[model samples]
Target: MRTLVIGDIHGAYLPLMQALDRARISPLDTLIFLGDYVDGWSQSPEVIEYLINLRSSYNCIFLRGNHDDLCLNWLNTQQHNSLWLKNGGQSTIEAYKRITQPTLQHHQSFLETLPSYHLDSENRLFVHAGFTNLNGVNFEYFPEMLYWDRTLWEMAMALNPRMSPKDPAYPKRLLIYNEIFIGHTPTTRMGITIPMNAANVWNIDTGAAYKGPVTVMNVETKEFWQSDDAYTFYPNENGRN
Candidate 1:
């Protein structure tokens, strides 16, 4: 069975479905989704609902993202960071408001149940962001960092491009996992709009949150599928940034 890992969705329901279709996902496949399932677009509720159903038919692993945490905080405390509203949280708020109370609760409960990261039998690590100080073979100690650290990716980027993955100075975290997959840090911010690889880590967040494409990769084959530019489908709104 193929193993597919999706990038950050950011509430683009149609694009998420498109990427899934392009990837040719099957019932037998293992699907691991990087987070930020809400925010950016008007379909956050729909996206969550879709995932809820998807889990019943396939092996679905959903990881928590910073945006997901922000959504949860707003749901629990009835408050959120001001920047959250500006960064696509407004759309999520409006989407939930449009749904019935029980439906909203379903979404909130789903968000709360999401794990910070997932480790597979092959020892591949899948996270919304990356880990900072992970204990080898037992990586969940720094659970918060798994969903919030950018340094993990930054450290890999800091290495000289010429250095091998076996280089002595390689970040310990990257060396621990057979391979790592992450989202949260969109590739577009770096002026490129595609999945990027540094050492053994892969950044698949191709920036669907900011009008870029939604992408999914086949973890084993390293093949991937990408949706159309997200903005073209929703021409009337501006995504995050």
Candidate 2:
């Protein structure tokens, strides 16, 4: 069975569906999702609902994202963080208005159960962001950093392409996992709209939360598929632009 890794969805459900159809996903394929499943568009509620149902028929591993955490907090506490609302939380809040109470509770339960990271038997690490510990994720001191930290990606990018892991200057964090997949930081920020590989880390968040498309990549072959720009899917809305 093929192992496919999907990038941050950010409530662009239509593009997500299109990307999946383009990829021709099979129920037997193992799908690893890097989170941020909500926020930034008009379909956050729909995205969560779809995912909850999709889990039953597929081998899916969902990781929690920073945005998902904020949404869960709001659902439980009924309070808002101004920064979150400004970023993409407002759109999620608006979409959730149409959802029934039981469905909302189910969404909340799903979010609550999501893991911060996943380590496959092949030693591939799938995390929404990155871990800080030199010893790796299991030793992480701050749990939230799993979905909030950018330092791991920054360190990977700073490594010299010619540098070997055996070299003294290599970052310890990169040495623990055979491969690391992350999605919190968009490749678009670096002036690209596709998956990026820096050292052993692969970033697949192709800016679906903003102007780019939803991306799905085969982890083994690196073959990928994308939909049209997510913003184009909702021309009337800005979508956290």
Candidate 3:
């Protein structure tokens, strides 16, 4: 069974569908989303609906992104915050306005239950963001570290200060993982990178909800499939906000 790892959707539903079609993903294939499923676009509600339905048709693993966390927090209290409103949360709110029951408790429950990070039997780790400590610690106690830690990601990439690939201090070796798949940070291009020899961390965020394309990568084959169209939620300089 092949595993397909997708980057942050960010409400770019059409491009996501197109990429999925291009990959020829089957119902039996394992599909893992790197989160940020909502925000940065006008179709957050539609994206959520599509994912909820897609779960029935495939082996899916959904991880919570920083944006998803904000949405759930806002939905529970109805109070707006900078993190929520500034980063496309306003668009998400607009998307929810079309629904008859905006506060869907069940949806919130699903989002809440989403794992912070996923590790396969082969020791491949998948997370929305990067972890600060590579000491084989549980991400639950350090959610922020997993969702927004750039230092740890850099250390893993540099592979420095550790003399040997087997050095326990090496971030990659600490996890005892073969590769790590992460999103949240947008890349100018769509492809894979082996940042470290031992770790092989791959970042797949292609900025679909921005001015770029959506991306999907086959874990085993390292083949990348991307949509042709450039999907964007933000308007032109003179367009409406």
Candidate 4:
């Protein structure tokens, strides 16, 4: 069975569906989502509902994202923060208005249950943003770092290609996993719209919240598929731009 790692959706539901279809996903396959599934576009409610239903037939693992945590807080308390509202949360709030109360509760439950990270038997780690602990994720002192930190990716990006794992200066976080997969920060920031690899870490977020496409990659084969540009599907909206 193939393990497929999907990037952030950011409420571009149509693009997400297109990418999954292009990948020819099967019920037998495992789907690992890097989170930030809501916000940015007009389909936040739909995206959450679809993912909830998808679990019935597919082997799926969901990781929590910082935005997701913020969204859950809003769902539970109906409180809105200026920071979240300005950064795509307003769009999600608008989309959720159409959802029934029961469905909202279900979505809230789903968000609340999401884990911060997932470590597979093969020692591959999947997280939304990253973890900073020298001893690895389990030893991370700040739990929020799992979904909000960028240091891990930053370190990976700055790592010398020639650095050996045995080198004392090598990052212990990167050394803990056979491969690490993350989203949250867009590869588009690095001026690309595809998955990026630095050291052993793979970043799958291709900036679906803006101009890039939603990406789906097979962890083992490293073969990937992408949808059309996310903004193209929502031409009327300024999706997190």
TM-score of 1: 0.95
Estimate TM-scores for all models.
Answer: 0.95, 0.99, 0.84, 0.99
- Candidate 1 vs 2: which has more lDDT: 2
At residue 61, give the lDDT of candidate 2.
95
In model 1, the runs with Cα more than 4 Å from the true position are 134-142
Error of 4 at 16 (Å): 0.6
Clashes of 3: 0
lDDT by residue (32-150, candidate 2, tens digit) is 99999999989998889889989899999999999999999999999999999999999999999999999999999999999999999999999999999999999999999999999
Error of 1 at 10 (Å): 0.6
Distance from true location, Cα of 39 in model 3, Å: 0.5
Candidate 3: which pairs clash? none
Better of 2 and 3 by TM-score: 2
Please identify which of the two predictions, 3 or 4, would achieve the higher TM-score against the true structure.
4
lDDT of 1 by residue, 25-64 (tens): 9999999999999999888899999999999999999999
Q: In model 4, where do residues sit more than 4 Å from their true spots? A: none
For model 1 the local lDDT of residue 210 reads 89
